[model samples]
Structure formats: C-alpha cells, structure tokens
Target chain A: MKEKPVLRVTSKLLIPPIMLFALYVQFHGDFGPGGGFQAGVIFASAFILYALIFGVDVARRIVPAWVSRAGLSIGVLLYAGTGVAALFGGGNFLDYSVLAHDALHGQHLGINVIEFGVGTTVAAAMVTIFFTFASQSPHDPEDLRDEDDDADFDDDFDDDLDDLIASRTMSQGLSQAGGAGGREAR
Target chain B: MELAVVIGMLFFMAAIALAIIWVRNLFAVTMLMGIYSLTAAALYVALDAVDVAFTEAAVGAGISTVLMLATLSLTKAEEKPFRSIQHPVSLAVVLVTGGVLIYGTLDMPAYGDPDAPIHQHVAPRYVQDSGQEVGPPNIVTSILASYRGYDTMGEVTVIFTAAAGVLMLIGRGRSGPGRRRKTWDYEDLEGDER
Candidate 1:
C-alpha cells in the first residue's frame, strides 16, 4: 500500500476537489437535488480517502473520534433546536413559516440552518464509523503502544509458520509487519 | 431510440444481478454491486429523477462501494460455502413477500397517468404553487425542507440513529485503555527502544 506512488499522488490531488464538491453539494441543496445527507457522506469520504492514503493515525489526529461523537450529538441538537426556535416564535414545532419576520424568509433561513446541522452530523458520524472499522487491528498498536515493549515483544517472534500459538498478539505482529516495510516515513 | 437505450441498460443491469448471484467471490460481488448501483443511478437519470440519480451515483455507487471494500478487508475475501440445508421457511418468506408486493402493485395507477391519484391529489397544488409558497426555484427542496419538514427531520434522525447504533456496536474503547501509555514523539520512542 505504501509503495504505490501513482495512487498516492493521484489521491493527494483528488482530496481537495472532493472536499470542495462536498461543500458545493451542502450549500447548493436548496437550488439542486443535493442535500445534507449526500453532502455529509461526500465530505466524510474525502477524509476517508485521506486516511487511506496517509494512514489512520494522522487522520485521527486531524479529526479525533471524540470530536466526531460530539458532532453527532450537536447536529441532532441543532435540528431539534431549530424546531424549538420556530415554536418559541409563535408557531408549532418545526413550523418554519413563523421562524422569521416573514414566512418565506423564515422558511429559507430555517431550512438552511437545519441542513447545516444535518451535514455536520452526517460527515462526523461517517468518518467516525470508518475510523472505528479501519483502526480495529492493524494500525492501533503502532500509535497506541510503547515502541520499546513493542520491539521486545517482536524479538520473541517464532519464525515457524505452523505455530499458531505464537500469533496471539495481533498488535505485536502488525507493528513488526508495518515497521519492517520502512517506506511509510511520514 | 430512447426506449431501446433504456431496454439495453435494463438488460445490462439484469445481467449484473445474475452475475452477482452466480459469482462466489465476495470481491467480485462487491465490484458487481458497485456496477449495480451505477446502473441504478443511470436508470434514475433515464426516468428524469436527477436528484435521486445524483444520490444513487454518489452514496449508492461511490461511498457504499468503498465502505464495502473496507469491510471486506476486515474479513475473508471469499464467502464460505453453505453448510446448512436450504430452508423452506426462507423460500416461503420470499414467495409471500413477492406475492404481497405484486398484489400491492395491482392498485397502483398506470405510470405517469395524468388522472392518477398521486397526480390528481396534492401534487398538482405542489407543482403550481410551490414557487410562490416556498419561494425556492427548486420545488423538490421546498417540498422536502418546508412542506414536508417533519418528514425530513425524521430522515435525518434515522441517519443519526443508525450511526449511533453502529458506533455502539463496533466503536473504539473496547481494547482496554490505561493498559498502555502513549509514546508519540518519534525521537523519544527511538530513545526508549534503544
């Protein structure tokens, strides 16, 4: 994976355009077929591509899992909050007509706000999900553990392919495997 | 000519579906499923469901394929052969569901009929007045975000709920934190290892 120069360069070039398209899809939903859900997925995918290229550790540092968890909650709050805002403005729950001075203006403003909330939640959730799945086994040991103990652990590795008992520690194996490549110098 | 093109595309989609069913390789199936969604997106375009086409192409064809490939990397590349006897219950369930679906279609009006219940009912009003009422150039947006605001909220909630469920199931923190300390600095890690 680290050896593919063509993929690395192409993906590096594609990430920004992908993110920009996601933004366009997010804001242009009102005038086109796109909306929060599609835009959110699109946005998350750009980061997913980045993670695939640069490895999960760098991606996690950029957009931590805790932030994503917060985003998931915040997006829901924003949508529900918009409804409450409309209600407090003398309309029923989610009645955007009363959200502003004029009904049309209120509708426009409310929809935009809610869509933003939707986009935020979706992008965060998708990215978090990808992180959780991708970071499950191979990448965690490298970043989350001490390299000293990791090296000591790897030194005890049995070269016998038939010894399944020696393969108990997946983290130990992955660290040795990845570090042995030595090409992914970031 | 348009009808011929549509028919050809439909045939291609059918072939892909049959291929998906026939192929034993999970990786090939994943690729076929991507093709399946792309074709579905094309069908949406043929039907002039541009918004749906966009979603079908982006989410259905693009993101889902990547996600599936990611999932595949976590597990075996080939599906195991069936170890259990085929169940009559599954066949019964499928037949019953198909029969019910076909029955439901009996009451559906002809495709694009002007006097269809859907066209005759609230849709005409939506088409005629949505521009003035919702004040958006896109009637679809007006209907989804304003006219059907509650429904859209519910859709967003569904995504949130699904993501929440998945996070709860497979999320981080299961590996027993506090078991190890972080050693992120490269120079410090090299010193420690030495």
Candidate 2:
C-alpha cells in the first residue's frame, strides 16, 4: 500500500469531507434523512478507507481496540442510563417527558442523547468487527490443503486478482490482498 | 413516474442478482452485491424511505462490501466449481415459497391507500402531532428516538452484542510473542515467519 502518491493524496483530500458528511448525518438526522445507524456506518467507513489505503496497523493506532471496546460498552450504558435517569426523574422506565422542565424540551434532550449513544455504539461495533477481521492470521495452511488442490498456484493468482480488483473497483488503495506485507507492516 | 422508476430500479436489482449468481469470482460477487445494495437504496429513496435509503447505502453498499473484501483476503478469491445447478427439489421449494409470498401480498392494501388498517392505528397520532410532541421535523426520527425509543435502544444493544461477540471470537487484542516483536524490517519478519 505504500509508495502510492496518487492514493495517499486522494485519500487525504477525501477523508475530511467524508468525516464531515458523517457528522452532518449524525446531527442532521433529527431533521433530515439520516440517523445514528447510517451516520455510524458512514463514520467508520472513512476510517476503513484510511486503513485500506495506508494499512490496518495505522487505522488500529488511530482507533485502538480499547477505544472501540469502550465505545461499545459506554454507548449501551448511555442509552440504558438515560432510561434509568428517567426512572429517577419521577417517570416510568424510558420515559423522556420528565427529564426537563417541559415535556417537549425533555423529549428533545432524551432523543438527542439516545441518538448519540446509538451512533457511538454502532460506530465502535463496526470498527471492532473490521479490525478483528483485518488483524486475523490470513490463512491456516492446513485448512487450505484439502480444498485448494493447487494451493501454491491459486494463492499467488488470488493475490494478484485481489489487487487487480481492488485497484480497479476502488480506484485507489492497492495491495490489500498481500497478507504477508500486511503482517510485516504491523 | 415514481412507479416507473421503482420498476426500473427493481429490474436493475434483479439483473445484479443474476450477475452475482453467474459470477464465480468472489470479488466480482462482492462488487455486484454492493451494486445491488446501491440500487436498493435508490429504490428506498423512490419509495420515500430516505432514512432506510441512507442506511442501505452506508451499511449495505459500503460496510458490507468492505467486510466481504476483508474476508475474501483471509480466504479464497474464486468460488469452488459446483457439480450441478439443477436441483429440482430446491427449485420447487423456492418457487412455492415465492408464490406463497406473492399470494400473501395480494391480500394487502394497495400502495399508499389511505384506508389501510395501519393508517387507522396510532400512526395517525404520530403523523399528526409528532412534530409538536417530539420536537423533530423528521417524524421518522421522532418515532425512532422518542415514541419507539425502547426498540431503538434494543437495536443499539444488539449492535453492542455483535461487537462483543466479535471481540470474544477474534478481538483478543495484539497477543502472542511473534506479534509483539514489531520490527520495522519487513524482510526480517518475512524470513522469520517463512
């Protein structure tokens, strides 16, 4: 993935806008055509693109395993905690009307808070799943022995084909299929 | 006009599906699946489900494609050749199920029918007063975050659970002595591993 000036420059130009759009979707979801789930996925996708172009290791350093894990737990807690707060606010479980002095204001606050919680968890979950998959041992040689009879030939061909397809389709970020390079880069 | 657009999009989706089925390369299949998801997202827009469209575009087209590509790296790029495509029993079962599904829809209300049973339910209240009640102009957001808050919370929890499951299965953090070495010399690591 290294030594690709075009890809690196393109990613640098595009990533900020993508992140901004994700935030727009996250916040404007209240008045428009997006919400937590969409925004979260969008947010993670920018990082995924970054990972693909640079390397998985770089992406991991930016949003480490612990950070994503914290997001996963904290998001759920924020949501559930909101409900618990409502219980203490002299309302039933999950009720939002009593959170503020007025019902409408309370609803606004509750909805925004919960939506943020949802976004956080979703984004974290996606990043975690991707990182886990990305970081796995590329192959268990024994598993390939039976299924891929021409293992040596097929492996090389698959790597080239993967690179070809990735470059052609994505138009940037080459060399994801080289697990050897990926591991060594780490 | 909207109906025509929907039908055209549906045809595109069907074509993509067929292409996916015909393609043996896993990479092409993944790409086709992304296209199919994009078409579906467009269909959602035509049907006025913008939220769903956004979700489909981001999650279905974007995330799923990337994940599938990552998985492809871990496995084979080409699908194994199948022995036979003519499975009469399976075909019969699919035809029967699809027929039943279409038959079921025949009993439902027409598109945008105002007198539908759903329109008569609590939907009226949500549609009419949700702006004032929830304070969001987008009724979908209002319902999702306020009226149906529990369901959304459950969905968030489900996502969290999925993350937890993935973490337990594979995200054990960077462990093992080999990974910990972390030298910048690619050749050294390569030689050692080989």
Judging by DockQ against the true structure, name the best candidate.
2
Instruction: Please write out the lDDT profile of model 1 over residues A1-186, one tens digit for every residue.
Output: 344476568878999999999999889998988888789989998888777665666667788877888888898889989999988999998888898889889888998888888888889878887766655443443342433433333344333321212122222222322353221211
Provide per-model DockQ scores: 0.29, 0.53
- For all candidates in order, the CA lDDT equals 0.72, 0.78
TM-scores for all predictions:
0.80, 0.86
- For chain B alone, what TM-score does every candidate structure achieve against the true structure? 0.80, 0.86
Candidate 1 Cα errors over 4 Å, as ranges: A138-186, B83-100, B174-194
Tens-digit lDDT track for model 2 on A37-71?
88888888888888877666556769977899999
lDDT per residue for candidate 2 within B1-194, as digits (tens), equals 88889989998899999999999878779889989999999999899898998899899998998888777766666788879878899999999999999999999999889999999999999999998888899999999998899999999989998888876665554664435433233464345434
Interface RMSD of each: 6.6, 3.8
Model 1, B113: alpha-carbon shift in Å?
Answer: 1.7
